[model samples]
Target: MRFLFIVQGEGRGHMTQAIAFYHLLRSQGHEVCGIIVGKSKRREIPDFFSREIKAPIHLVDSPNFVADKKQKKILLGKTIRKNALMAPTFWKSLKTIHQVVESRNPDVILNFYDLLGGLYNFLFRPNSRFWVIGHQYLIHHPEFIFAKGKPWDKFLFQLNTHLTALGAVQVLALSFLPKNDLINSKFRVVPPLLRKEVRKLEVKTEDFFLAYMVNPGYGEEVLAFAKSNPLVKIKAYWDKKSAKPIEYPLPNLSFHRVNDQTFLQDMAACKGLACTAGFESVCEAMYLSKPVLMIPVAGQYEQACNALDGEASGAGIASNSFDFSLLEKAEKKDTKVSFQFHQWVDSWPNILSELIVSAEQESGVKNPDGEFDSSPVFG
Candidate 1:
């Protein structure tokens, strides 16, 4: 079977998921014909995608969030306005998606929760079967707890999830903690898609912490912490524009641009991961049996939910700020959760096979070549 991956190129999370699934499909004798990633002005298609995925990647303009002056919080109004102004570009990108799908003639299309993927499906109504995967879909689960006192934020975040999952036949909801499937809905609770490199790291008990910040503002908090504790060392990764290699901001702190290998190596050696509550990084930290101090990005309800869920999953404690004091107290995290996590991670091939086949049959689509991955969606 042939597949095409449509990814949201906002951060390393979606792209990393795509890389993992691409390898999984190939290992199962399926071909990934092409990849289409939605691009944002603030982000660059990371080197890892091309260096690792081994697919012809197509990048096109898509809607993205606009951050505030501090680059910490999402400016919802400004974001909508900016993307509204780029309406013409997005429309063209939609058409481009149609052309790619048509030319690739994939057996199935997988969406990594890309907004353009949902919009294209909703508007273009292409005949190809589509499956949507992301931790965001877990929001729809009955047992899924959301952050309180932010009904409006939760509503908007869910709206975005629905938009990205608009026409999906199967919604693969990645979970921080396993829950029962959504009864009578096109949702399945699946393990987080952790990269192979992360799973294979040789972890060491180091003294310094690994800090990953999607927003640059969090670095100041880390820097402030470092200033107070002059002896403690911090290695932080940020997507700061035009940043030099070694950004020596404070005596005990250094900031590096987002580099996959460097980040993974640091993850192996760090005492704990002090970062935002993005699903992917937390999962990676857990797989390495490293504790985390998660600070959810401001106004992102999804991250708030992730922070809470990650805590429940025994990833580490959650904080509203980058306070390294918490790291010292919680340095020796338990390894018991890792056994269950690895068990869940190992089950993806069979689970996804079942879901893909189920989606194809439910959509009433069959291949012209009489080839179908009729394997059971579950063992």
Candidate 2:
């Protein structure tokens, strides 16, 4: 079967999920027709994705709903304002995307949380089946549990979910937590998608701590904590303006950009982690049996809930702020959760294939189950 994958190129998480799905499909003897990546001026496509993903990549200008740094929150007003301004560009991109999809005539169209997917469904009305797949899609399910917070904040999250769900044939919500009220609506619960590389990497418990802050605001706080502790070797990944392999005055601290090979290598060697409570990173850390100190970005509800869930599951400690004392205490004790992630990893490919087949059949697309039903190609 030929599949067209639409991805939101906001962070490493979406791209990683795409990479995982791409490999899984190919391994199952299905062909990925092409990839449509939403491009943001603020972010550059990482080298890792370009080099690793074999499919042809096309860029389209899409709406980006980003956090407001000044307010230190996700300003729905600002998000709407910015997205409104980009409407023309978005329309143009949509036209191009529709042409690409029509040319490919794919068996199914899979979306990796691209807002453009909603727009694509709105504009193109393709005869091909469309399925939305991502962790963010969990928000749309009625079974998802929302952390108690300001009413407006909660409303905005719901609004975000609703917007993403517009015209989606099926929504796949990925989570490590149990399904709840928010997740049970309009979506099927799926396990977190992890890359084959991550699954294959050997886990080793070393003395060093792994730290990553994709947000620059938290870089100084983490660096200070790392610097204060001379006894602990800190291999931190920072998103600051700096050269690679930047050695700090502190003997045991070092920082690098998003170097996949180095990051995975360090993760394998780290005893534990001190990082922001991002879903993918935390999942990877837990898979490697590394306890984490989850310092969520202030005013980011998702990260806050992630931190709370991580703590609840005994995977890590949650800190209201980045504190060296907290890190010191967490380091002395072990809080790794013993979970069978291998089961999820092994089942993902089959699950994804089944979903694509189901969606295609519903849309009356020919070759609905694609190559999977015809023969056994992958071991």
Candidate 3:
């Protein structure tokens, strides 16, 4: 079946997931016709995307999280106002997506939890099928456990997840651990898609604690931690565009801009991994058998759940602040959990194939080879 991807270009996780899934589908005899990525003036599509993804990538304006002056916490009030101001541009971008889908008439519009899928279904009311793929969607599973935090924040986050799934035929929730006894079988739980570059790496233990800060505001905490612990080497990667790599005078801590290949290699060999509790990074850390120390971004409830879940999966500890000291204990715990997660990762391909066939059948479109009316019969 022909598929088109709608990705939220807010972070590396979704973008990498799209690239990995694109290749996976192609390998299974499905064609990815086009990719529409939601982006903003504040951020451009990462360079690796154009070179790595086989399909053409189109960037369209979308709402972005606005950070406060420190650029660390997501200011929810400010974020809403900023996106409200850009409503016109965002609307036009959705219009462009509508035309693309209408012209291509793809059998499935695979959404990487982009907000546009809902808007497009509401505006154009097209016959296309949408499958929302993201770890965030796992929040709605009846048997899924959420992190303990502010009740309001958890509610808002779940509401946002449902909004992203508006008109979606299925929510292919990506997970770090396996929970097959989900109360809502309407949604399928699948393993996180680690970038192929990451999965192929030869794992080892090195001297450093590799770190990534999704919001550069967290950089201050990293610097403070590195200063306090002078002996532990820390190599961190950030998306601080227009900034040169810095080798701190502290002698053991250095910050470099994100380079996917280098990051994966460093993660594979690093003594431990530290980053915001984004689902994909935690999954990669687990896949590499590296211990994790997660600090969820302030005001992002989805990440709070990830931190709780990651720790529950035996990955590591979570901190409200940058406590790199936890790496020592967390690394050993992750070792115990790695085998179970590996089983989940190995199960995705088969489960995903079944999902694709079901989605295509409901789409009322012929399978790619036209031999089956709706079932995806692989070559």
Candidate 4:
């Protein structure tokens, strides 16, 4: 079968999921015809993704969040206004997606929660079967628990999630813990799409703590922590394009650019991880058995939900600020939970293979050539 991946190019999480899925499809003797990633001017596609995925990537202008001056909180109002003004550009992007889909004509189109991908399917209604993938889809699960308060935030987040699933026939909801599939509603609970490299890592517990901030704005908080605790070493990574290869704001504090290999190595070696509540990294830390401190980006309800879910799954403690002290003072984390989570993650291969076939059969879409397409998604 031929597959085409449409990924949202916002943060590292979705792109990493796409990379894992790319390798999985190839290993199953299926072809990935092409990849269309929705991008914005705020960020660039990481070098590791292009180098690792080994596929032709198409970048299209799409809606994205607007951050405040500190680059911390998500400015929902401003974000809507900005994307609303870019309606014409987004329309062009939808057309671009259609053209790519028509040209490649894959057997299955998988979207990693890219709004443009869903919008494209809604407007064009292509013949290829479409499926959506994300942890966000788990929000509707009866067993899922949401963060306290923020009713409005949850509603908006769910609205965006729905928009991204407009024409999807299957919703693959990635979860930290196994749950019964919502078959009646086209939702399947699946394991996290962890990359092969993660499994190959030699885990270790080093002296320093590691941190990853989706927005560099939180670096200030990390710096403040480092300043107060001068003896404790800290290694932080951020998406600051203008930053140096390695920045040392203080003798014991250092910041590095977001590099896939380096970040994984750090996660394996660090005593604990303090990062914004993005799903992938927390899962990585759990698989590596490293305690985590998740501080959700303000106004990002999805992340707030992630922090809550992660804590319940025993990833680590949740905090509203970058307080390393909490992690240090907190009681020992549960190793049993980590063991269970690792087992859950290790089941991805068998589970995903079976689910993909089920999804194709459920959609009733045959391969374009009456057989699996042998041609590669990229040359």
Candidate 5:
């Protein structure tokens, strides 16, 4: 079978998911014909992704949305305005994507939350089956846990769901939340899709904590924490947008630009993680038996929920600020989330493979795997 994937390029998470899925499909004897990446001006596609991926990659102008730094708010107006300005370009990119898909004639199209995929599905209406795969799809599930906040926040959350639901035939939601949270939804709650590197790694807990954050303001706070902790060595990664790598030698601190292998290696070697409460990284850390010190980005609800859930699962501790006391407390706590995670990871591959097969079959494509040939939708 042939597969085409459209990935959102807003962050490394989606790209990592794509890479993992690509390997899984190839391992199952399927060919990935093409990869369409939605590019954001603010982000450059990492060198590792370009060099590591096996299939042909194409860039497209797709809508990119981000949260505001100070308040951790969505900045809906700004997001809509920016994405609206790209409408013409997005449409043109859709034409290019359609042409590529038509030429490739993939048996299935898997989208990693790229708005361009929604646009493509809206325009061409391809006969090939389509599946939307990502952690973001969890937002649409009715049982999805909502952050404690204002009513307007809830409204905005609903709006986000409506926009993301456009043109998706199937939604795969990744969450640590209970199965009840995923019940009665059009989507399926699957285990977080971890990268093969993370899945295969052997974790060792060393002295230093591994920290990474993409947002600038919160990153500064993390740096501040490292500066004060002279006894504890800290290794961090950030996109500082500087031509030269900035090194702040505080006797116990180090920083590097985003490097996949280095980051994974650091995670494996670290005692724990001290970073923003992003789902992908948190999942990776938990899988590696590393406790996390989760600093929820100031106004982002998703990160807030992630922090709460992380704490609830005993995977990590949550803090509104980079409090040294909280960090100490988390460090002193026994890191036992490892035992709970193995079962989750063991079940995920089968869940994802089955979903992909079902989506393909629904679109009239034959499934090569008899084990997953039936259209089974498990909650």
Candidate 6:
């Protein structure tokens, strides 16, 4: 079967998931014909994604959050106003998506939580089997735990989740641990889509701590903390386009541009990790048996939920700030929990293969080898 991917380009998590899924599909003898990624003016498609996906990538104008001057907190009012002003551009993007879908005519359109993908399906009503993949979709699960308070934030988060899954036939909710499938619903709980590189890494403990911050503004907090504790060594990565590849302002503190190989190598050997509460990195750390300090970007409700969820799953402790000291103080994850999480992650191949076959069968689509049957297959 042929597949098309539509990914949200806001952060590293979604793109990483796309890359992992792309490889997974190819391994199963499916072809990824094309990819349409939601893009904003502030960010560029990471080189690693382009190299790994190895498919035609088209970027289109899409809604993105407006961060403060320091790029620390997301300003809700300003974000809504800014995207509202970009209505025309986003409309053009939707048309582009429709054009691609009509031209490619793939058996499946896998949406990685991009708003435009969902919008295009809703308005254009394409023929392909639509499936939504993201951790945010887990919010509707009855047993899911939410962060305390912030009613408005929770509402907006759910609203976005709903919009991204407008016409989805199957919603794959990526989880840290296994859970029962949502009965009589379109939701299925699945493990994280970690890339092959992450799974092959040789884990170890080193002296220096590692950090990954999506909003470069959080670097200020890390820098301040580094200065206060000059004896502690730190290696951090960010997507600051203007910064040099590697900068060492202090003997014990250094910053590097986000490079996939270097980041994974560092992660494998680091003593601990301090990163935003994005699902991908936390899961990576958990799989590597490294403790983490997760700080959700302010005003990103999905990330807030991730922090709570990560804490619950023994990934690490969540914090409102990038305080390495807190990570140092926290207890290490239980060996049993680490073993269980690893076992859960390793089960992705079987779980995902069943899901793909079920989705294709439900849509009455032929396999890549041209095998087709109308009889429904039970999952």
Top model number, TM-score: 6
Per-residue error (Å), model 1, residue 271 = 0.6
* TM-score for each model: 0.93, 0.85, 0.92, 0.94, 0.86, 0.94
Model 5 clash count equals: 2
Candidate 3 error regions (>4 Å): 181-185, 245-249, 331-336, 363-379
Question: Model 5 RMSD to the real structure?
Answer: 4.6
TM-score of 5: 0.86
> Could you tell me how far off, in angstroms, the CA of residue 166 lies in candidate 3 after the best superposition?
0.8
Residue pairs in candidate 5 whose N, alpha carbon or C atoms collide under 3 angstroms: 71-299, 72-299
**Of 4 and 6, the candidate ranking higher by TM-score:** 6
Ranking by TM-score: 6, 4, 1, 3, 5, 2
TM-score of 3: 0.92
By summed lDDT, the worst window of 10 consecutive residues in model 4 runs over: 370-379
**Which structure among the candidates has the greatest lDDT?**
6
The residue-level lDDT of candidate 1 at 20 comes to 91
TM-score of model 2 (CA atoms): 0.85
What does the lDDT come to for candidate 5?
0.72
Which runs in model 1 stand beyond 4 Å of their true positions? 359-379
Please give, for residues 18-64, the per-residue lDDT of candidate 5 as tens digits.
88778777777789999999887766889888877888999988887
The pairs that clash in candidate 1 are 354-377
Which order, best to worst by lDDT?
6, 4, 1, 3, 5, 2
Cand. 3 Cα-lDDT = 0.79
